[model samples]
Target: MQEDVLIEKIKKGHKQALRLVIEKYKHTVYQVVFGVLRDEKEAEDVAQETFIKMVDALPSYQQKGFKTWLSRIAFRTALDAKRKKQRQREALTEYAPSKEASKSAEDEWLQEEKSRAVTASIAKMPETYKGVVYAYYIEGKSYAAIASEHRLEEKTIEMRLYRARKWMKQHWKEDDF
Candidate 1:
């Protein structure tokens, strides 16, 4: 069957056509995903996710280059998976100590207490600076990203964060955080 006919059939909710499309483009999808994610297991998983996404995305299938569209989906899926994995690794390392960190039990306890103190300090901040502080520090967002999300300028975010940190410092002792 021709690619166009198979796509039309998939868009019209024909399950068999969806299977055929998957079978036909499976190799291409796997290659694209694998190119982005070096791990074979993750590549396979992302390739499956790409096919699932392709089914939902087929309803918007007005483009002429079906292969290109599918490859784009595969590539994006792989990248998203890679980013998620990276974020997970970062989260794991953010709290736990490593040999290079050399933090002792006393230091770990102090760090936990400091974290709690910082949370309390943030809670006491004025509403204007509170949201930006949480987004930047806790959520790990860049100033530009926080600004875009709140529809404010990046400089405004920077100023607010700076003021918030100053407020925290003045309100608490030096060893608070």
Candidate 2:
């Protein structure tokens, strides 16, 4: 069957058209996903999802280069899956303690209390002031990057950082920090 005919059948909700679609493009889609995810099993899964999404979106298919469209779906699906996997892995690492687990609860409580006090101090700052401060210091964003991301002038970011530091010095304690 011609690719266009198969796509038309898919748009008409012919279930068997999905098989032909998958058979024709599975390897191409799988290669795109695997290039990003570097995992064969995950690539296979994303390839399947790409075909499913393509089938569901068939009505919108413009008969443009179908391979290009399918490859884009595969790439995006792989990227999304990679992000989810990364988040899960990061969560595990964030909760795992290399040494902190050996410390007493009182030690951890003291740390938490200090963090809370500093947070309260930060909360007292003006909203516009806090955003730049967090972006530059807490998030470690460069002035140029922060300016671009927030659509602010670089000098404005610098000024906010200066004020936020001064406010921190006046209101926050070293012990609490």
Candidate 3:
């Protein structure tokens, strides 16, 4: 069917028209999202979301080039998914410790001791640095969250973390643990 005819049918709530639209443009939408996300699963998910958004926004859509508008939506949806995934990765890295596949009792004890020592070191830092360090490293809060919680700018939170690390390097000793 012609694009304009299909669109008109869709506007009138024709189910077959919606299905035909999906069949006609699904590959193009998937390719557009996949090009940006570079992950098959994520691309598929974002492409589905793109279609949903298109359906919701269709009533307001001008009769411009449909493919161009659809591709733009797909691109933005993929970028948003990519950014969300990145933030999740950063949070996981901040909170989770790297562990070997297997560990003996001695290794477990040593790990616990190291964790305790690190906690102690953080506790001993200056009051100004302590909150940012704990929120970021220990609590796994993002800079934006920490800044909002403390009513400070994100750059100030970053600067505080940098200074905190510098202070730790100056004051802490490996032998002390």
Candidate 4:
């Protein structure tokens, strides 16, 4: 019956009519998105997303100003895309440590967890094993050094550390480390 408007044609069947709508408004959509995004590739991408959004929103659209409504969709879609890009960029940009590299939150957390687990596990050892395990593993002392510190023979230090390892293997889960 020729409502004779682009939006009217689009609302009726929407396949080929949507194509006409896009062809008519593509430049406006691109400009609206580009005004906010300032990147040609991203603007183009957002313009496409904006069209899909417009078609989805067309059912809810009363016959108000079509161009204003369409531009608003383009603007909002661009901003949403921009915010998403910023978050992704922020996520990717981090972890590129500077020359004076420092530990990341994840690394620091894992180190602390490992240290605590080892210390707590060692604390559960018998008195005879506790000193040797702490000195050999936590303090990074050699068998001879631990023996000298404890005034025991080197073989005694080795035996105690071996026994401590066996105890830990039995008592702790495989993933404790």
Candidate 5:
């Protein structure tokens, strides 16, 4: 079967073929973004972006190493999104916090504060280490899948996750969790 056949069908808006393509590439795209963003929700967002780009560019997609090309696009898009988010966060952090806040022993407020603190700690972690933790724990991605997506050995992914968890434990108390 010619590659263009699938491409043409997809470009012409054939839902079945489009769905097939999505199924084929969805995990790959999700793994790529998850390896970078270290957040399941953010990875899902980037995966959607990847699919959108694939659909929009389908008509002009070249036949050379299609999967690699798709992977490259997914990788770049995720990194760009991460950089943009980091910049926005830094800008927001520049704002001074209010000094006088009401005391709150309420469960909702305590929970919210704890969530914020955990998020902050995760954000502080080095990107590579954080990626492993998010992929394994939060995304519930397997070590083997992560290793394959990243072209690394499974042991490496395991070690990264192990160290990341240790770092989190050392830096954050159980109460913070």
Candidate 6:
């Protein structure tokens, strides 16, 4: 059948025209989707989806080039599927720790408890030393940065950290962790 005749039949809601369109374009659509997705099952699925979309969108389609328009639908559908899969993979990786991390539920709990104890110990320190210890250790700031922020000499920041460590050692027990 001619392309223009097929399109007119399709526009008039002829089932035979729809079936003929599918038969003519299925392989091209599958290949286009497969080129982007690289997975046979997903490519097939996207190709099917493209045809369904074509049926819905046929009324609005300008008769430019039927093959070109159909191929564009297939390409866009495949790209959308690829992007959705990538986003799902990223979401899984963001929260899932690597096997090399070797952290158990018990280990996580113990680590949280130790952190709380350390925080309590730091809170008990004198006001001047507390800021220095927090900046250098918890906040991971350099001595120079801490000094600049606090309007003090770098040497003063170092001395305060030293004093804080000594205070922690004397006041906090090993069991506290």
Residue runs of model 5 more than 4 Å from their true location after superposition? 1-3, 97-177
Least accurate stretch of 10 residues (summed lDDT) in model 6? 97-106
Cand. 2 Cα-lDDT: 0.84
lDDT of each: 0.89, 0.84, 0.92, 0.86, 0.82, 0.91
Model 3: lDDT equals 0.92
Q: Which is the better candidate, 2 or 3, if ranked by lDDT?
A: 3
Candidate 6, number of clashes: 0
Instruction: For candidate 3, report its TM-score.
Output: 0.55
User: What does candidate 6's lDDT look like per residue over 90-160, in tens digits?
Assistant: 99999898875888889889888988888888888899898989888889999999999999999999889
lDDT for each residue of candidate 3 in 1-177, tens digit (9 for 90 to 100): 898898889888899999999999999999999999999988989999999998888888798999998899899999999999999999998878667646778998998998899889899999999999999998999999999999999999999999999998899997977
Cα-lDDT of candidate 4: 0.86
Residues 103-163, candidate 2, lDDT per residue (tens digit)? 8999899878876775676677889877787677667889999999999899988888888
**TM-score of every candidate:** 0.55, 0.55, 0.55, 0.52, 0.52, 0.55
Displacement of residue 92 (Cα, Å) in model 1 is 0.3
Better of 2 and 4 by TM-score: 2
- List, residue by residue over 122-150, the lDDT tens digit for candidate 4: 89889999999888778888988888888
How well does candidate 2 score on lDDT at residue 102?
Answer: 78
Which ranking of candidates, highest lDDT first? 3, 6, 1, 4, 2, 5
Poorest stretch of ten by lDDT in candidate 5:
96-105
lDDT by residue (tens digit), candidate 5, 94-125: 77464334445686687787767766778789
Is candidate 1 or 4 superior in lDDT?
1
Deviating ranges (above 4 Å) for candidate 1: 98-177
Q: How high a TM-score does candidate 4 get? A: 0.52
Q: Which digits, one per residue and each the tens of the lDDT, describe model 1 over residues 53-76?
A: 988888888868999999999999
